[model samples]
Target: MWAQAKSGPLPHPITAAGTAPVHDPVPGELYFWPTTDVLAVYYADLGQAVPDPGLIRLGAIDTGLDDLAHAGRRVTVRIDIEGVQ
Candidate 1:
């Protein structure tokens, strides 16, 4: 769990590109995103064959009410996704 949401899409994608993700928080309504199709459908682990974004599920994260704080606002968090190379 990472953020809180009231409704709608998560403020950010789930397990985004990274070998070491800094999980700093978790919420009750939290959920690993980009797992289901409606969110994301594809993902890859670098050298691994790139799955179709429509069929791949590389990661998920937590988002909920915490995100709604800046509702209608723009927030930016950086995740480092990379190639196997």
Candidate 2:
């Protein structure tokens, strides 16, 4: 599914457990669950409906949170630590 989504709509591999229940998924936050291989973002404002639960946190959205509007929307990710450089 991910392979096909490389260019088109990519759907998150929802597992039985789902992502950790984020009561307040802050905008610009990204999460990935290894068990399900699902990637999600908090495109909406904080304290919105929970995306998924039981996901192994992937990372935070540094930029482009506005672009993430839907659930199955695809996105590019980049990781960097503050004060590391």
Query: 6 in model 2: Cα distance from truth in Å?
Result: 14
All candidates: TM-score = 0.21, 0.41
- In terms of lDDT, model 1 sits at 0.32
lDDT (10s digit) by residue, model 2, range 1-85:
2211112222646443544454344556665544456555555563344444433444576765544454244456445657655
| Candidate 1 weakest ten by summed lDDT | 37-46
Q: Give the TM-score of candidate 2.
A: 0.41
What is the lDDT of every predicted structure here?
A: 0.32, 0.47
